[model samples]
Target: MLLYHTIALAAGYLLDLLIGDPRWLYHPVCLIGNLITLLEKGIRKIFPKTEKGELFGGFLEVILVCLISLGVPCAVLSTLYRYMPLAGLVLETFWCYQLLATKSLKDESMKVYDRLKNGTIEEARYAVSMIVGRDTSELTEEGVTKAAVETVAENSSDGVIAPMLYMALGGAPLMFLYKGINTMDSMLGYKNDRYLYFGRCAAKLDDLANYIPARISGWLMVAAAFLTGMDGKNAVKIYKRDRRNHASPNSAQTEAAVAGALRVQLAGNAYYFGKLYEKPTIGDKLREVEPEDIRRANRLLYGASVLSVLLCLGGRLLVQFLV
Candidate 1:
């Protein structure tokens, strides 16, 4: 089982690195997101309007989404493996590929970088807005550059390393479960009046799920910085010093590392939902952040991703050998 899983994971990693996510293909996360939306509508009607009621409803949503995510994939994969091992491995590899977001992250961020390099500040803002949760209408070129770099840094963990970790541990089914958890958090884990009470469970669950993976990602990114010819020593320094400088326990882990490696400040105040959020900056501002930093950040992302997969494959081999 471990041997097959290891093979599938390696193949999937190569596929994602080569092609990224294709616009032509329908993604599994779309289904997960659609399910969350459908569930939220039904849950609102069935549950009361009170705070406790919404909390319960939110908890219920988490349970249902996670169960379906894990259960459906497990059933399909198990059935296929029972009747046809080759077919099972292929599907699992596809799922593993879909779950990761390495080249996609780079591609999206580079859209902003391209616009910025071309001196199209408005277009750059629009491109960055697509990837970031914050408002982008009035951002300066520097703001857009920082936003692109920050998304690339933070998602190095959320969108890449964390999902990879889950897939390595329990194959694609467990990674699906992680995606469900992550998707719920992305959709429902807001702090505004609408989602504060209702999204409490999801927010907390996401924090718990990402706690260890985020830290591991931070360390791996530090090593990646060295491997990619960035500031590895400063990456370690900022990772330890500023890794906790976020509202999220997990978000700052990789951001700090990237900021340190690139020697630019990140994670300052930003507007979300038309409201200004006062956020502390990450890393030392040794130089101005430029459009080129986006490419550098992607380099770190790729380096970290390569290191993570190597470690995961090594672990799997060690386990199989011991058994």
Candidate 2:
């Protein structure tokens, strides 16, 4: 049983490594993603559009899912894989970690850097738009670069690292359940009239799940920067000063750290659907962000992410010894 799990995981990772996130007909992740889209529609159907109603419903969704979808399934998987259970778990963990897109995140961010360095602000904005939720138009060179750097740092955990973290502890079903929760939070976890009530739980739950891992990823990124010969002290200094600059308690913490470490300013004014959102600055100073920053950030992300895996595996192994 464990052998199949190990082989399937390796195969899935190879598929991702070779083919990337193509919309292939047979990809398990894509198929799961599609099914999740349908599940979202069902979740949305149960709640009315009222703020009060949505809030209650959203809260219910988080509570119920935690107890059932994510919590219960993971518990079951852990029990089933019990033998030299720890070793079996190591295989699942590695597989799930591979599904995350840290490498791709770096690659995508670097594309923005490359275009911007070529003196194409317009192209850079267009490219950056894919990775971030903020409006890219009207962004200055500094703004665009900072946004890229910040997102690269933040998503290194949120988009790539967290999923793998969960999978190592759980397995496919629980991993998928986490993905569902994440996808729902991304799409519907808003606080305006439309999603205020309905999206409440998803947003909060996502925040809850991310708190520990995000900070962990931040620390790892700093170490990665140092190991790779970037400015380690600057990263630590900025992280200390700017990690809490954003409205989001967790996101700003890691992103601000990354900004400070890199010795660049991140965050400011961003346009979203024509509305200007004034955001706090994460780094101390503003410098002309170059393409190399993007490259450096990517390298840092990979180093940190891989290190995270090693640490997790080591921790699990320690647990085995204690048991």
Task: Indicate which candidate wins on TM-score.
Answer: 1
Candidate 2, superposed: residue stretches over 4 Å from native: 1-20, 23-48, 60-98
Every candidate's lDDT: 0.94, 0.69
Q: Against the true structure, what is each candidate's TM-score?
A: 0.99, 0.81
Candidate 1, 70-170: lDDT as tens digits:
99999999999889999999999999999999999999999999899885788898899899999999998888899999999999998999999999999
Clashes of 1: 0
Best candidate, lDDT: 1
Clashing pairs in 1: none
Model 1: residue 185 alpha-carbon error in angstroms: 0.3
Put down candidate 2 lDDT per residue, 1-323, tens digits, no spaces.
Answer: 43434443444444444545543434334544564455556766887667666677667666555455555545655675775665555545444544666656766888898888785899998999988898788887777877788788888887766765665454455566667667667776876777777777788778887888778888887888788887788889888777777777678766765676677777777778888888888776646676677777777777786687667555545655575
How far off is model 2, as Cα RMSD? Answer: 4.3
